[model samples]
Target: MRTPPQRGRRQGRTTSRELILGSARKLFAEHGYAATSLREIARDAGVDPAMVHHWFGGKEELFNACVELPADPAQVLGHVGELPAELRGEALLRALLTLWDSPAQPALLALLRNVTGSKAQAALIRQVLFKRMLALAMAGLPGSAAELERRGVLVASQMIGLMVARYLLRAEPLASAGHDELAALIAPVLQHYLTGPLPGTGSAVPGTGHG
Candidate 1:
């Protein structure tokens, strides 16, 4: 059998894992998820392909690591997409709110905090919002592709703002706000962003008139 190519200078376990992740984030961003390969990632990290599997089971898990999301987004948010379009906004929010209440909060907060100042991170964020979650939510819903994309981005913007305000920055009453209260306040705007028409001038969309 052909021996695997020699890897980079022997490195510590932590260094090896970090190298794999760094290589993964860049390649995933540049080439996208489907096009990137385990062999490619391993090669870039200067590790044996076996090391990639040892660190992260497979491509999905590897990508999850690159994103620092603790749960599979499909499992967490996928069901929300199955609901009626009108109900999706709230469902999505409630699902996320539920996850935030779990032990994953720290990792999620770190993800939100680190999204700034990194183009690769920004691209991964876009994939979650526009490519994955949005595709699932908007499936079978009516709208032009551009309009749907705009709505999806708006929805993502609100959710991100909520995460930062409530969890990361811990700003004011928002930080103290009850989950139900936040749901009541934010869900409608999310629904609107999903289906309501955008105004020609202001950012105001409906369900946002009060808070």
Candidate 2:
């Protein structure tokens, strides 16, 4: 059998793992995710680049560790399936808004800032939203796979736009809008994405294809 990996520092008080993470967090903040490289982080931490892979699987995992969210994305999307189909859209909006309004807001804001600052960060957000969040939300919804994908994209677009306006740029009326009011206004479009008819497609009955 191959030899097991070594543990602990040879001399310094700080572990190589801690140093790597500290360097990664600092570099990611300063240069953004896409701009920072694994080698660069290793150099700054005074460790070999291989140590980064040993400590953290990859840059994405390291980023996730550094930017731990207060809430789980899958758990946050859980309410979407529980609500009545007609109400699911509103419920999703309200949930998202509540999350932004919570103490977790700072972390969420930092995530958004990082996404805006780096293409790699944006890709990670897309993966989480599409693979995890939207996939969960789309479960039991009516549509062909293609149709479901299209609807999911529309919903993501709407949500991202709302986040940019309300949270990031702090656009006027939306920024000042109450949670309930915003939900009332935004829910219909989301509902449309979930179950309503597209321009070229036949009408879809609400609550069909539910498991």
Candidate 3:
């Protein structure tokens, strides 16, 4: 009988990538984003530091890859985009609160925790929010570029502050309140951020300040 051919040893390349990502996620969750370095992740994964850079390019990219959300932010916020501009803010706030209250709460909390713990992670979070969430949410709204930027920043600040208060800190009332209740309380502020008058701009925005 002909001798059986020897199978090649498993290269384990994919395993290495998985290991890196797994380590990154754990470290990011535990130590926050800025404090967790590529070298530490590689060491935790039993891989070389170079492997991390090879796999993820840099810490920012690695953080992005590791921080996977349970839902698509674009889709979650898309309904707000679909609504009339005047109505978008409350819908957006309601939708955001509902998402955090859902099964994805843990992951959302984790991301928020990581963001609070590290400035680097905070920067990464801002980038992701602006690129993925706020950009879509702000689409087609009437404003100069500067006005739009200010509005987006204000909206994000409100949402982030709410998340920190209600979810992370578990502040009473807000923590226990239902989504609709919280949304009702917070949506008007967000509406102002979305379409309200700016500090110096004299131009009036149509469909704004109506509700």
Candidate 4:
């Protein structure tokens, strides 16, 4: 068997596990997820390929780590399950913004930025955010599947736009806004999406109804 090449002195201080993760993150970001390989990651990390398997069970597990998802969204959302319907939107967004503003957000930003770099990343985001997280949230709600799906899409759209404006484009006002203020500004729109009537329903969305 061929011995793995040793890293130069500057790279020597880096541990094999850290090296693998860093290399994987970069490769996954630069190349699409599907194109990146454990062998390549091991080579970049200056470790034997076996080390990658020893640390991470497989490529998919490594990908999950790279993406930096916190708890599963369903699990995260479930904690607020007891919140009243009228307050759920604000409450949900408040919790989200709080999480996004925490230390975890930087990792999330890196994960998202990497994902945005390629088609494979986009597909992966769709699966994680839309299909897994949001879909589960919708299923837990008492509503038609169409309604749940539509509302989930709208919430995602708003959140994506906010992320783009706040982080990527760095729109001045929003970028500078406090998280609480931002949540206040965004929660109503989110509320509308979550409980609002379907466009063809001939009525204001549920939460918006004058009653």
Query: Which stretches in model 3 have alpha-carbon errors above 4 Å?
Result: 1-11, 14-64, 203-211
Give the per-residue lDDT digits (tens) of candidate 4, residues 68-167. Answer: 6754565566655566655667767766667677777777787668676766566666656766666544546667777778788988899888887887
Model 2 lDDT, full chain set: 0.78
Q: How do the residues 1-211 of candidate 1 rate in per-residue lDDT, one tens digit apiece?
A: 3232344544476688888999999998888887899999999988888988888889989988888777887888878777888898788888889998899998887777668858889888676657776777667777778777788888888998998888888898888888889889999889888877786424654463555
Model 1, residue 16: C-alpha shift (Å): 4.8
Best by TM-score: 1
Candidate 4 colliding pairs: 197-205
> What tens-digit string does per-residue lDDT give for candidate 2 at 75-125?
788868766677778878887888889899988988888777766556656
Whichever of 2 and 4 has more TM-score, that candidate is: 2
| Model 1, runs deviating above 4 Å | 1-17, 46-51, 199-211
RMSD of 4: 6.8
Estimated TM-score for each candidate: 0.79, 0.68, 0.68, 0.63
Candidate 2: regions farther than 4 A off: 1-67, 203-211
lDDT of each: 0.82, 0.78, 0.79, 0.72
As for candidate 1, its clashing pairs are none
The prediction achieving the highest lDDT against the true structure is 1
